[model samples]
Target: MIGIDLGTTYSAVGVVESGFPILLANEEGRRVIPSAVWFGDGAVEVGEKALRRRGVSPVVTSVKRLMGRRPGEVDDFPLPLDEGDRVRVLGRTPEEVSAEILKELKRIAEWRLETEVRKAVITVPAYFNDAQRSATKRAGELAGLEVARIVNEPTAAALAYGLDKLGEKARVAVYDLGGGTFDLSVLEMRDGVFQVLATRGDTRLGGDDLDAALAGWCAEKAGAGAVDGRMIKEAERVKRALSADGEAVFRVPFVDGGESIEVAATRRDFEHLAAPFIERTIDCCRRAMHDAELSPADLDAVVLVGGSTRIPAVREAVSAFFDREPDLSQHPDEAIALGAAIQAGVLTGAVRKVVLLDVTPLSLGIETFGGLMNVLIPRNTTIPAKAGEMFTNAVAGQRSMSLRVLQGEREMARDNWRLGEFEVAFEPAEKGRARVGVQFRIDENGILEVLARDTATNRDTVLEIRDAAVDVDDEKVETMVSESVEHAFDDMAERVFTEARLKAEELLPAVEAVLSQGDGIVPEEEVAGIREAEATVREALDSGDANRLKAAVESLDKATEAVAARMVERAMEEALERRMGG
Candidate 1:
């Protein structure tokens, strides 16, 4: 059995031998495989060697970006090259690209183990939405591997660390700060059952952003007017260097025959520059802990995964947040792959008693009148959660009624993204007479499936939401996929803008309420700044610019910390006073 850590920056393949998971090294003796693929001369090449051909070949990284996109949903995906880069986006789905990577892993596993590897377990972000999860499964199918199960990255890390501590129950928080994403999950383990209580993180936030920020800082220090790709790559190198050492000096290579410049960063300075990113993840951890109803002291242990977690600052922040020195014996980069192998054993009945219970990451709701979204399943809700609602015809002799499904926590359906639509036919009857029972079920896999039953006739209809937004045909999918590649960076920027705006809107009213109540000891100038930030956010929203919304909200977030802290304290005090009958 094989386990694969299908990561954003790099991938690792491993197998269980005598109960120990061992990573398989490639011919170059590197255990970590670059998650890069280049198409050249009708051949698909993956990993480090192929990555060298990136500029001329069509290369894709973070294909995971396409995980949950609906059919026909158009967005630029990262091809990481120019349109004339000789790599035409033709007939290859993200699923296929991912499959090629998995296939390479499988081939490596087979070659190393001296046997045909067929079954495997794969790790995914615990917070991966439905589309990404399904795309992973499809990638496995395309690779011709029996995907034993899709295990959460944090869960796998916990298992890799906890297998030695069986029979003892522990509350574990897995802090996974990876190359491209961050996920903090709280789990309870007892009697061979690993139950996830709550999980939170941003799929877009990670080390990449930190590197980009540092790169910009370096560019400014170099007296450059604009930061370019080479500067960004140099900054990333400095970041990686500072991870293990106390200080790192970057000697930037000049691009236009100009003299090279050196930029130095101490670990402390790096942490300061990366403070906002670390703090953002810490906030997410707080939310997850709150959702699980567990405090920092309640966590028996903290486990870290991802290359980013190797940073001393990240470890310190996590330790401070959870109030525990996390177990660092497991290699952050390889832990997930090891845990995946363990899961494979469980699925293959090699380790016959442990079971994992995952949960949905976001709220799934239906669009009501006035575009209000009624949530069916809220975020952090236990997996396999089921809910039912009764529907009836509003007009006389109505034959069909439609159910518009959405996912997100926004109050308005228009604000939330639509997942799909389901329509059920019923026997014609008087207005508001025909009753149809609609059941929305989310499986352990977190995919939504709908079932509608006609109470009048005992007839039933079941529908699985299709990717009507995805171009499935080889040619069309290929063309769109290529187009997306060309526009990938732009698309990501736009998405970030959109998410930021939504977050700002979520915080605005609360900030205003606090100001009205004089809840905190915030200075007048700070309060004014918060208001200013709110206005900027609202303006971005009104303009319908997702990117602007994101930027404005981020600006507001930076300016309103004092206000937020005070508001939270006031809320806590009121709750405490009410609880004590004061």
Candidate 2:
């Protein structure tokens, strides 16, 4: 058995060798495979070869985002869906395209091991609905591998982290921002057991969105024409470069048939462009921490997973949110696959003494009176578990009742996703009738099953739902924290600017007064540095960027410290002179 990280942008296969998990390199000696498939000349190509044929052949990438997605729910679907809830990728189903990528990964593993690999564990985003998970499992089956388990990406990363730290008891928050999805999971490691306390995420959020945002922003700022696939690829390259350098140039040739567009953006500009996506992930982290009932101080470490976390801005954002630097102990791209390999090792007797547990991503419930959501299984509940609630007929002499099953983080049923509804036969009785018990059972794969039982006559009505309205509850996540405090972000930005401006207004005058008193106390080179800092502060003030202004003002304060000490000395000398004269 091997372990696979079927990612949105890249995929990898790993296995346990000598009780140590390692990712398998393919014939090309590449450990990571780009999650792209190209259909051209009646043949299929996968990975880097396919990614290179972006404009030539019909290439499909980020197909993971299209799984179980409606035509409108997602901003950009790699393919169009057929009538039967299937996507047609240039006559091939989305699953088939995904299967091709998985098949390549399997072949890589088989070649590395020099043996047949069948059974495997795969990882998915913690927020993936049952529908999406099922699609992934089906893809695995199509790839000639038996699906042994479906582990959440964050949980898998945590498993990798705890593989070497089994004896340490600590709480960890895994911040996973992959290519097409993002999830944050809070977990605890105790005596070799890894327990996920809570999980929160937005499936529609990830590095792809950041790339698109960067591409569009650069084109508009460069005064160039509309963006295209070429520009998007360039933006991705620039983004990767910005992860290491302070600034990078985005260049797209022949953007409008003749004119080439060139845009240079500092890391700060890119961070501003990427701020909204980061803020959304931070919102998810806040919810996950709240659900886990833990604060930043309570977490011993915050583990970063997925390729996007390599960006310096992303690391800084996570550090700010967690109040501590992220633990870069695991490879951002390979940790999930390696963790899955560890789990596979545990199951196959290669590894020993470890237990793993995961939690549901959202609250599950049914609609009650007045369109309210009555939560039966709250978000963060331990999975492979069951919860039940009792209800009665609302009207007198009712023969049956209709209930809408919902999943979300909202209090209103209408605001949540209606997973599906079912009709249960109710015994005729007066209002507030006999106890009808409703139970929700969720398995380790996050698939849900609902059962309604009549206590009076012991009759059971079962309803099984497989399809989700959308792959992610992005609408609800958008409102999770923003709606709670309307205009708070905008107001906070204004407040930040005002505060920074006030500091500059006060600090500049104080420095000038000291400079006017005398120049001997402050060195000429130091005086020149203070003037340069003041000019930089003024430039930042004119820019109207709160963060930049704040940074500049702080720098100026540090530069003028010598002058500030001179003011104190002069004041003391004047006091002594006045006393002597008196």
- Scored by TM-score, the top model is 2
* Candidate 1 structure quality by residue, lDDT tens digits, 1-582: 788999877898987777666889888898889887877777888998776875455567666655555433323334432233122234467678788899999999988989998888888887676667777888898999988778788888888887776688999999999877788889998988888998877766677778878877877777865665456557778998998899898777664568786878788888889999898889778878878998889988888889998888999998888777987888988999988888877766666567788887667777653345677788778877899887678668889878787776555566456667777788899967999887779876666787778898888888766543122321232123234346667655555554565466567876677678763467777877888888888898788776678778889888877666776787899899999996
Measured over all alpha carbons after superposition, the RMSD of each candidate to the real structure, in angstroms, is 16.5, 22.6
- The CA lDDT of each predicted structure is 0.76, 0.84
Score candidate 1 by lDDT: 0.76
| Candidate 2 C-alpha error for residue 541, in Å | 57
Question: Where does the lowest 10-residue lDDT sum fall in candidate 2?
Answer: 467-476
TM-score for candidate 1, please give it: 0.74
| TM-score result, candidate 2 | 0.78
Off by over 4 Å in 1: 54-58, 69-92, 225-229, 256-261, 368-372, 410-415, 457-461, 466-582
lDDT score of model 2? 0.84
